[model samples]
Target: MSSSFFGDLRVVLRGARFRRLFGTRLVSQFSDGVYQAGLAGFVFFNPEQHTSAGAVAAAFAVLLLPFSVVAPFAGVLIDRWPRRQVLLFSSLVKAVLGVVTAVLVAQGAGPAFFVAALLVLSVNRFFLSGLSAGLPYVVPRDQLMMANAVTPTCGTAASSLGTGVGLAIGMIGGEDALGTGIILFVAALGFAAAALVSLSLRYRELGPHLEEEPEEVRAAVRNVLRGMLSGLRHIGDRVPARDGLLTMGVHRVLFGVATLMTLLLYNNTFTGGGVAGLAGFSVSAALLAIGFFAGAVATPWATARMSASTWIASLLATAAVALVVFGLPFSPVLFPIAGFVLGFVSQAVKVTVDTLVQRHVDDAFRGRVFSVYDVLFNATFVLGAALAAVFVPPSGVSAAVVVAMVLVYAALAVGWTVRARRLSATCKGRGALWA
Candidate 1:
C-alpha cells in the first residue's frame, strides 16, 4: 500500500462522527443488497418464472428506470428537506414496501409485484443522495477524499455481504415463491435496522440548511426543470467536469451491456433452470464484488504513477481489449473472469471521475451536478440494458453484441486519449487542470 492510502485511512478512522455516519451508510447499503438480491432471485431464478433477454431487461428497467425518471425530483427533495429526516423516513418507507413486496411475490402477483418493487427501489434514490450530501458534515474537508474512498467502498462491501447472505437463504429455501418471499422478509428487517441506525444522528447533522425561508411547494415543483437545466449549464462551462462526466456516462452504458449479458448467461445458459442458475449468478456477483474492492484498494496506488486522466483512459482501453479476449470463447467459466475485470476497470474509472468532478465543480453546485450525474448514470445504464435486450439472445452468446461493446469501449478510450492530451497541455500552462 502507498503512504497516501494508509495516511488517508488513518485520518478517517480517527474521527468519531465520521465513523457513526459511515455506520449509517453501511447499514443502508447492506439492506439495499439484501433487497436487490432477493428481487433478482425471485424474478430470474424461480422455477415458476420464465426467463428471456427481454424479460431480464424489463426487470432491470423496473429496478432502475423509474428512479432515473424521478431522480431530479428526488434531488430537489434531498436539498429541500433535512437530510437526516430524509434518510430515516425513506428507509422506513422501504421497509414497509419490502414487506408488501414479499407478500406480492408469495402470492404470485405479477404486475402488482413489480409496482411494489418499484416503490421499494425508488425510495433508495433519496436515501443514497442524502448520504452523499451528508458526507461533508461528518469529516473535515481535507479528509474528504479519504472519507469518500472508505465510505462507499465499505458500504459496497456490506452490500455484497448482504447478497451472500440472501444467496444462502435462497439455497436453503429452494426455488419457489415461498423461498423468495422469506428472503424478502429478511430484507425488510435489514431496512428496519438501517432506519434504527439513522436515529443515532442528530436532527440537523445531515443538512442542506436553507439560508432563508424558501419557496412554496408548488413553486419548487415548477423549478425542478430549471434546476436540472442550471446543472447542465454548470457542467457545460467546466471542461474537466464535462469530460469526466462524459467518460463516466460512457462506462455506465458499457457496464450495463456487460451486466445484462452476465445475467442472461448465468440465468439461461450456464444452469438454464432451477436453483442452480441462481447459484451460478450469485457466484458471478461475488466475483464482481471482490473486483470492486480490489479496484478501490488499487486505484490510489496506480494513480501515484500517472495522472488520473491517463489512468482512466488506460483502464478503459484495457477493458475494451479484455472483453474481446475473455468473451470471444463465450464460455461460462470465462464469464466470471470477465465480470471481475469489468468490475475493477469500471470502478476505477468511476472513482477517478468522482474525484475530478469534486475537485473542479464548486460546492454550491455540487448537489445539482451530482443529480445530473445520477440521471446520466441511470439513463445510460437503462438504455444499454434495453439495447442489449434487442441485441443479445436468450443464450447470452451473441457475437454481434460483443463486437458492439468492444467498438464502443475502444472508441471511448480513444476519445479519452484526445481529452487527456488537451488537458495535459492546459495543465502545463495553468498549474492545474481541475482547478
Candidate 2:
C-alpha cells in the first residue's frame, strides 16, 4: 500500500509542465528562505541598527510593498512576453543584485548598502509575483491546489533549513567579517543557481496570438491600462469574482497580521544563544512546515470529505482560534505546536480558496484576476506590517496587538462565511459554471 501511494505521487508529480516549474520554484524558494533568514540575522546582530521587532516588521513591509504596487503591470508584461523568458530575466536580475549586495557587505559597507540591497530584493519580489500570476497558464485548472500545496511545502521546508543554517553560521562568525560575508555569498550562489534553472525552462506563449503590425502593438500598449480598468469593471459586475476577491483580501489581511506578530514575538521573546533560541526557531519552522505539508498531502482527502466553502469556513475559524491562543501567555514549548496548527489551517483555507478562484474565473482574464488578487494580498500585508510596527513595541505591546488582530480577523472570517453562504443560497438554482 505504501509503495502504491508513492507510485501514485510520482505519477502526479510527473504528469504536467507544472512539475518542472515546481522543481525550479523549489530551488528559488530555498534561496529566498536562506536570504531572508540571513538578512534578518544580519540586522539583528548589528549594534547600530534597530534590532527591534519593528525593524524586522519594516523589512517585511518593504519586501511586500511592490507586490501590491507593481503586480498589475507585471501581469500585462507577462501576457506580452514569453513566460519562460520573463522567469529567466527576473532570476538573472535577482542574481546580479545578490552578488552586488554580497560584495558591498564584504567590503564593510554601511546601512546604505543594506538598504539598497533590500530595494533590489523588493524588485525581485515584484518579478516573483508576476511569475505567480503566470502559473495558471502553465498547468491545468484541476491541478491548482496541488501546485499551491507543493510550492508552499517546499518553501516552508526550505525556510526551516535556512533558519537553522543561518543561526549556526551566525554563531560561528562570532561577529567576524568572514562569517557575515560567507552567509551573503551563499545566498548569492543560490540566486545564481535559480537563474540557471530558470534559463532551462521551455517557453510557451499565452494570451492572444495576434499578428498585428508595429503600430498596432503600440496601440495595444496604449490600451493595456484601459484593458486593466475594464477588467476591474468586469469583476465588479460579476458577483462570484467580486465575492472571491473580498474573501481572498480578508484572508490575506489576517495572514499578514499573524505573520508579522509571529516574527515580532519570536525575535523579541527569544534571544539567540546556545540552545533555547535555536531550538525554538527550529521547532517553530518545523511545525509550520509540517502543517503545510500535511495540508498539501491531505488536500484531496479534505476536498472529498467537505464542500469547498465548508472547508474554507472551518479552516479560517480554526486559524483564528489558533492565533488567539498564540496571543495568550503560554509555555515557549507550546508556541511551535500552536504555530503549526495555525499554518496548517491557513494553508488549507488558501488552497480551497485558490481552487475556487481558478474555477470561477474565465481563462481569458484569469491572469489579470490573479494579479489583482496578488495586489490585494501584498497591500494588506504591508498594512499589517505597518500596523504591527506602530502598535507592537519590541517588548511590551506585542501580545495585545496580536490578540486584537486575531479578534478582528475572526470577525472578518465570520462575516465572509455568512456572505458566502447567502450568495451560495441565492445562486443555488442557477447553473453556474464554477459550481
Candidate 3:
C-alpha cells in the first residue's frame, strides 16, 4: 500500500506541468521559510532599528489582508489571464522587491526598509493566492485531494529544512545586516527560479473568461458581493457542497486558532530559556512538519476507508482535542505531542476540504469558490491574531486569550458539524437541492 501510494505521488510529480510548478514551489517555499525565520530573528535582534514586534505583526496582518479583500478580483484575474503569465509576472515583481529590500537594508535605511519589505511580502502573498486559486486548472479534479496533500506536505518539509539552515546561517553571519543580506539573496533566487519555471510552462486556456460581457461583469461583481449569501443559499440548495464547505470552514477555524495559540506560546512564554527555548520550539516545529508529511502520505488510505466528510469531521474533532491538550498546563513533552497531533489532523482536514471543494463546485467557478473559502480562512486568522493582540497583554493574558479562543472555536466547530449532518439528512428526505 505504501509503495502504491508513493507510485501515485511519483506520477503526479512526473507530470510535465505539475513538475514545473512543483519545482518552482519547492524552491520558493524553501526561501519563504528561510525568509520567515530571518524576519523574526531580524525583528527580535534589532527591534530598535526596524520596529516593535507589534508593528511587525501588524505588517503581517497587512500582508494577508488583501487576500480576504482582493481575492475575488484576484481569482477573476487568475481565470482571465494565462496562469503561467500571471505566475511569471508575480514572481518577477517579487524578485525585484526582494533585491530592493536587500539594498535598502544594507544601506541602514531603518524603518523605511522594513516597511518596504512588508509591502513586498504583501505582493508575494497576492501571487501565492493567485497560484492557489489557479491550481484546479493544472490538475484534474479526481487527483486534487492528493495533489493538495502532497504540495503542502512538500512545503512543510521544505519549511522545516529551510528554517534550520537559515537559523544556522543567521547565527554564523553574526549581525542583522549580514543575515538580512543573506536571507534576501535567497528570497531573490527563489523568486527568480519561480519566474523562470513559470515561463517554461505551456500555457493552456482553462475556460471562458470570468467576465467577458458587461452584464457578466456586473453579475460577477454582484455574485462576489453575495458570495457569503450565495454560499449560505447554496448550502440550503446543495447538500454535498454545503456540507463540505461547513466541514472545511470548521476545520480551518480550528486549525487557525490552534496555530495562533502555539505560536504565541512559543514566542512569548518560552522566551526565558534562551537556546533551550529555541531548540524546543524548533523541535516542535519539525515534529509538526513531519506530522503533516505523515498525514499526506496516509491520505489515500484514509480516503479509501471513509467518506471525505467523515474524514474531515474526524480530523476537526482530533484537532480540537489537541488544542485542549496544548492549552493544559502539562509537561513540556506534551506540548510537542499536542503540536504534532494538531499538525497531522490539520493537514488531513486541508486535504479533505480541498478535495471536496474541487469535486463539488462548478468547474467554471472553482477559482472563485476557492477564493471565497480562502478569504474566510484568512479573515478569521487575522481576526484571531488581532483580538489576541488587543485583549491579551504582553504577558500571561495573551496565552489565556489564545487558549480561550481555541476552545470557543472548537465548540462552534462541533456544533457546525452536527448541524451540517442534520441538514444533509433533511435535504435527502425532502428531495431538496442539496445533494
Candidate 4:
C-alpha cells in the first residue's frame, strides 16, 4: 500500500463522526455483497434457471433499471430532507425488503422476486446517494478526496468479502430455497446493523443547509424532473465535472460488456462448465476485487503527481490497450489477468471521477448531481449488457465483439486524452481536478 493511502486513512478515520458514517457504509456494502451473491446464485447459477445472454441482460436490467429511473428524484430527496434520517430509514427498509425477498426467493416466486428485488435495490440507490452527499458534511474539504478514495473502495472490498461468504454458503448448503434464503436473511441482519450505526449521528449533521423553509423543500421534491434537469445544467457549467461524468459514463458501458462477456466465458467456454465455471468466475471476481483495491490505493498517489484529467486519460488509454492484449484471444489463462487489469483501470478512473465530482460540485446540488451520476453509472452498464446480449454469442468467444469493444475504448481514450490535454494546459489551479 502507498504511504499516501495510509496517510489518507489516518486522517479520515480519526473523526468519530466520519467513523460512524464509514461504519454505516461498510456494513451496508457487506450486505450488498451478500445479497448480490445470493441473487446471482438463485438467478444464474441455480440448476433450475435456464441461463442465456438475453436472460442475463434482462436480469441486469431488472436489477439496475429502476435506479436509473428513480435515483434522480431520490437525489432531490437527499438534498431536501435530512440525510441521516434517509440513511437510517433506508437501511431499515432494505432489511425488511431483504426478508421479503428471501421469502419470494424461497417460494420460487419469479415475478414477485423481480418486484421485491427492484424495490430493495432502488432504495439502495437512495441510501448510497445520501452517503455521498453526506460525506462533505463529515470530512473537511481538504480530506474530501481521501474520504472518497477510502470509502467506496473499502466498501467494494467489504462487499466482495460478503460475496465470498455468500458463495461459500451456496457451495456448502446447496443453491436451493433454504440456503439462498438463509444468505439473504443474514444480509438483512447486516442492514439492520447498519441502521443502528446510522443512529449514532445527529439528524442534522448531514445537511443541505436547510436554509429554505419546509414549503420550498416540499415544492422541490414535487418537481423532481425539474430538479434533475437543474442538476444536469449545473454539471454543464462546470467543465471538470462535465468531463469527469462523461468519461465515467463511457467506461461503464465497456465495463458492462466486459462483465457479461466474462460471465458467458466462464459459464460455457471454460473447462468446467457448471460448478467449475462458477468457481473460476469467483476466482476472477476475487482478482478483480483486489484490482479495485489496488486502484483505490494507487489513484490518490498518481493524481497527486499529475492532473486528475491527465490520469483519467492515461487510465482510459491503458484500458484500451488492455482490451486488445488480454481480450483478443479470450483465453482462460488471460481472462483473470484481463479481469484484474480492467478492474484496476475501471476503478482508478471511477475514484478519480468521484473525487472530481465531490470536489467540484457544491454540497447543495451534490445529491441531485450524484443521482444523475448514478443513473449514468448504472444505465450505461445495462446498455452495454444489452448490447452484449445482442452481439456476443452463448459461448462468449466473439472476436468481432472484442474488436468492437477495443475500438470503442481506443476512441474514447483518444477523445479523453485530447480533452484532458486542453484542460491541463488551461485550468491549472488548486481546485479538485488539479489535485
TM-score per candidate, chains pooled: 0.92, 0.83, 0.81, 0.95
Q: Which residue runs does candidate 2 get wrong by more than 4 Å? A: 1-9, 45-50, 162-177, 205-224, 272-279, 396-399, 423-435
In candidate 1 the C-alpha lDDT for residue 345 amounts to 88
Query: lDDT at 98 for candidate 4?
Result: 96
Q: What is the lDDT of candidate 2?
A: 0.62
Candidate 4 residue lDDT tens string, 206-298: 997757445544455557787777788889988777888987888888899989988888877774355676788889899899989888888
Ranking by TM-score: 4, 1, 2, 3
Model 2: what TM-score? 0.83
Best by lDDT: 4
* Deviation of model 4 at 203, angstroms: 0.6
Task: Name the 10 consecutive residues with the lowest summed lDDT in model 1.
Answer: 212-221
Over 4 Å off, model 4:
1-3, 212-222, 429-435
Clashing pairs in 3: 237-433, 238-434, 239-434, 239-435
C-alpha lDDT of all candidate models, in order: 0.77, 0.62, 0.62, 0.84
Q: Per-residue lDDT of 165-264 in model 3, one digit per residue for the tens?
A: 7778767765557666677667777778778877666665333344554554435435545543444344356556656666555555545445544544
Model 3 global lDDT (CA atoms, 0 to 1): 0.62
Clashes of 1: 0
